[model samples]
Target: MAGITGIGSGIDIDSIVKASVAAERAPKDAQLARLTTKTTTQITSLGSFKSALSEFQTAADGLNDASLFGTRKASSSDATRLTASAEKTALTGTYRVEVEQLASASKIASGSLTGDSNLAFASGGKLTIGLGADSFDVDVAAGATLKEVRDAINTQLNEKGISANIISDPANGTSQLVLSSNKTGAGNDLTLAASGADLQGLVTNRPAALSEAQNAKFKIDGLSLESATNAVSGAIEGVTFTLVKAEEGVSTTLTVGENTTAVKDSLKKFVDAYNKLITTTNSLTSFTKVGESGEPLTGALLGDSTVRNVLNGLRSELSNTAAGQGGDPFRALADLGITTQKDGKLAIDDTKLTAALEDNFDAVGSFITGDNGLMNRLSDRVDGYVKSGGVLEQRISGLQKTDADIKEQKADLETRVAAIQARLYSQYNAMDSLIGQLTRTSDSLGSALSNLPGVVRERS
Candidate 1:
């Protein structure tokens, strides 16, 4: 079998050096495998930690997971802490309220007014006509400036929630400032008056022209209490509302909840990570070498007890219960569908793993995430190894140092070996060249002797 081939025509110093390099890296690969396994284990352990944290939040452990997700509810100013239980919260309350409907007097109160236009201008007395937008009392005095009327209208509109403006005939310069109510209904009644007397014509319009109604409703605790417009004070808390209709009321009940999604997600994420680590670790042993090369799995960590011990510790820690607790995180690897065989190798039981997770999530959560949580310990281990002076870091540092030293030693040796090979090649080439020159010289001498037969006979 062609195990390996080289580009060089023959064995040389370069080939020897290449072989040495390959040998050195074989051991380095072993070290790399161990690190990879450790990293995978540490990562899985941390994942288990977070899952436990999620379970803690789900129970009445009282740390609302909603706050962790950024939707913690605002505390109301009047919020009272109630001794509410899950059982008690589900029960609804029955409410009762009473109200008075026919409270308004049977008769409509009435008033009237007349303006300066009805009598004469230049009269000193002014009629004060109040408008609805405000308590704007218009001064309808004879020869009184229009500006005064406008000011009164504006003031009344601002104060009384009424509107007043002049509707003037542009052609005649006669303007009647009108009044209207800001609200609906006859409650916004119109009134008229005169201050300097003789302007009593402003009140000349009698009460005969108007009719009005009084409206009322009742509500209790935000629900329609009933149609009570007026009530003796103090029924429910400090709130006594004027109910316009028995038909309309606000919702009296509210529902409060917490979102455990983040906590759930955090837990789920940890499970996935743990599973992935197991898968990856198992792959290290699973890979079959059925190819022509048939190289054995020869990583430095292939048979290291360190890797086995780490795995054992992780499983042991998880199987341990929290302090003062009755049960272990897991009853057995089999509970999680993980098992150890005759050869002491780990095996996965997917069905068992699923069952364990489904039954008793809190137990599983605590098992993985609690103070004595598996994840915390795993993260601690991973963090230690990954840090600047941790195991992985230290290992890598050592490898680099070894590589540097090896390179230096190899370089010095290569120089010496190259010099020897060069000398050997030079001596061989010189010997071959010398042999060729001598053969040519002999051939020339023999040819010269043949050509000169008489001289050749004398020499013979």
Candidate 2:
């Protein structure tokens, strides 16, 4: 057999064809990828929605309410409402009045002291003493012991007010409890002349009853608002702005925001995305390549007029006029410098667009933000495509599976072809070697005939 071997067999035309077919199904590989389109739309819608909410929030954060969380501290100036008993309700407003009795106005201490020169009990520990008509007990220290006995006497001592306190006694090493009352108002005025240890300078002076003031003040969006009492409500509709702290000035600078650059950038993005979608869609339309063999997308979606109609509608849809509460706010995308062309695509004029935002921000907001906005619509379409049975998701999945299958089959076919090539080369080498041996054998036979030439020459 010849030593020569086969090279590639024939060109693997089947491999090429199979590869092409698999590639043709490549779009199906993107089915799942397409499903995420809805998520993108969802994110867009959520952003727009949040933007809308921020607008209202800005208008609702100005008023202040004091009574709800804070309390006006009580002072000595609180108005006095005389009570016949301790169950008396608190008085309203501030005042300066002398109290006849702390616990009751009806029950007044009567009679005068006899044995002891002063009205103070023994020292300031625990004293069991007898009063006008009833025996009483008193304990005096500094503050609590001072008010505790007074409270007990005011509520129980003939229902009259009783006040007492212990004075620091340097002589006895123990504090003395001083007890006194203005049982005879304007006359007794309550006197405390401690006996061997009387409250000489302590019980002589006293403070008059007082009341505190209660009122609230606040503003909304820089407008002065008032509350009848400390508790305020209905200052602003839809949202109540509480004035936590009273503002001294009227013209408060509300530093909202002036970042039109980002908004302008968003406009450009919308335009760019719109055009890209249109261009992609157009490639599938009657727009054909000059010498291409086939149209990549030549069916209802690609070449169909109906498809163009839908696309043309999108120009209107994206730039659709939106009405605002203030009138023609979202009248047209051009209003926001988002202009539509005859080619059914949109473009943004960055400078003019940003200027428009400064002049009238509500219009731009109405288009992409409010009820039935472009973001919401686009998101809905995207959402539909991303779910389990969506078109893009299914198409991408199909393409991917198809590409995978083709790749697998191509690998298998290459292996089998390599095996076949090895076998064919083996057979071709055998035939080439047999041809070489036959040629050598014929040459040896011719040489033997040449040696018998001398006998023929003698006969001649």
Q: Using TM-score as the measure, which candidate wins?
A: 1
Q: Quick one: best lDDT, which candidate?
A: 1
Off by over 4 Å in 2: 1-272, 275-313, 319-337, 347-367, 386-389, 451-460
How much lDDT does each candidate structure score?
0.43, 0.41
lDDT of 1 by residue, 1-460 (tens): 1222222223343455445555645565566556556555444443343333233223312222223333212111111211111121222222233333423411211122223223243565554544333344455556554445545556745565544454445565444534444333334455555565444433444343232324344444445432212432343332222322222323222222222334444545544444544554454334456678887654334454544554565556445444325445464334555565554444555555556654554455554554454555555434443445765455555655655665565566557555655554554445555666777798999888878846645454
Model 2, residue 225: distance off in Å is: 15
> 1-460 in candidate 2: lDDT tens per residue?
1232322333343444446544644564454345444434333433332233232222111101111111122222222221111101222223222221122111222222222223343344433433334345544433333335445445554344445444444554433344554242222233222222322222324222111122344444444444433223343221222223332442222112333444555555555655655555554443445456764433223444434444454455555554334555555667666687888667677777767776765455545553365555544434434345654445545645655665676566557656655555455545545655666677777667656756444354
> Model 1: runs farther than 4 Å from truth?
1-254, 257-259, 287-300, 322-371, 381-383, 405-421, 451-460
Q: TM-score for each prediction?
A: 0.40, 0.35
Q: lDDT value for candidate 2?
A: 0.41
